[model samples]
Target: MRLVVCLKAVPASTEVAMDPVTHTIVRDGGDAVWNPYDTAALEVALRLKDEARAAGQEGWVGVVSMGIPATASLLEDALSRGADEALLLSDRAFAGSDTIATCYALTLGIGRLCAEPDLILCGKMAVDGDTAQIGPMLAAALRLPVVTGATTVERHGAAVDVEQVFDGARRRLCMHGPGVVTVDKDAATLRMPSIEGVLAARRTSVPVATAADLGADLDRCGLAGSPTQVVSCFVPERASDAVAIEGTPAEQAATLAYLMGEVLA
Candidate 1:
């Protein structure tokens, strides 16, 4: 059996700033880290591999990440954490990709790496985009069954079961064959890398595949294929003012309420 996990590199800081002129993420000169949700997805794949081994079947875990050339470091991190293989999808033409384009490129790359994976995992959402759209999109494009927001997963024989969380309920999903699932925030965290693993990961030669290598259509793998367009992106100006409340405590409370009502109205 083979398992594949999808990953994204996101800004380390939560307060990621946008470029005032370009209206795009200020990705330059910022520390980039693997998406937290993707880490959970990796952990899920590792655990599934362990279970499969115990069941007398061996499984390999691989990861696929798409971004600039710098993102190869992101895949190395996954290798350090114990993925058996990693693939990087980097190309200039892949810039400014929306979720649709992203899913297309990812599915193309993953399909090349693992023609028939027993399972596929992804984070419930990317920290930067927070759209949570790629997992299902990839599944649909590949014509495979999918379930999202999985907090727990179990595999028995050829069937995979997951505890899927929705708005106000948790549904148990069972798939009889190869399928995809997105790990929720509540999934297990990954273990830290060992000294030897860290050094080995740095030496891991991750192969990069471009749009041509993945056989991705030029029009469907980048900004040109993206339907969503950004009109503008700028931080909202903060407005702040202080008002003095001159009176007894009761009167101050009443004045505060009145001011709040005015602001709300």
Candidate 2:
């Protein structure tokens, strides 16, 4: 069984910057980490790989991400945690992409990974984008069935069965062969890298794919292809409504106590 996991490198800090001109996240460089939800998907892929090995069948997991050159570091991290292969889709042409354009680039690169993957997994949504649109869109692009918000997956020969969570209820679904699943963080716990695996990651050479390599239509990529436009990005103003008691320290304390008593009463 072959599994393709779409990984994403998101800003580690909440203090993400925005580009003034392009209106895109200014990822010029700060520490980056693999999206935790995507890590959950990888965990599922690893478990499936182990199961296939136990059954004396071939299992391979390939991890791919789309971002700047720094994204390779995240892929290497995946390698240290047991991903069989890694690929990075990075190109100047892929900048300022909205969810639709982003999915298009991913479809191109994943297509290059394998003509037909047995199973495709993605994080339910990226922390940076938080749109949760890529998985379904990519599935549609490839003409494959997809299950979103999947909490559990069980492969049955050529078919895969999945359980999805919604409004505190779980629903089971079975999809035909060659499908996609968007996994939530609750799906599985991620494993840490082993010492030996960390050492081996240094020697792994990850391939980089350009827009041309993905056969991307220049018009349908980057800011040019993105339909959604950000009119402006700014920090929201914080407002609070409260009364200030002005007096000597003791008097203020007494007034605050009286107010608290009134509220409690």
lDDT of 2 at 135: 94
Give the per-residue lDDT digits (tens) of candidate 1, residues 1-265: 6999999889988787765643457665358998889899999999888788788888799999988888888788888878889999999788778889899999888888788898899999988877889999989999999999999988878898899878889888888888999998679898787788789998889999999998889998667878885657556899797899999999999999999999999
**What range of 10 consecutive residues in model 1 has the weakest lDDT sum?**
21-30
Model 1 pairs whose backbones collide: none
Question: Which lDDT values do the candidates have, in the order given?
Answer: 0.86, 0.90
* Clash count (model 1, backbone only): 0
Give one digit per residue, the lDDT tens place, for model 2 in 132-229. Answer: 99999999999998999999988888788899998899999998889999999899988999998888998998899999888899899999999996
lDDT of 2 at 199: 86
**Among these predicted structures, which one has the highest TM-score?**
2
Q: What TM-score goes with each of the models?
A: 0.87, 0.88
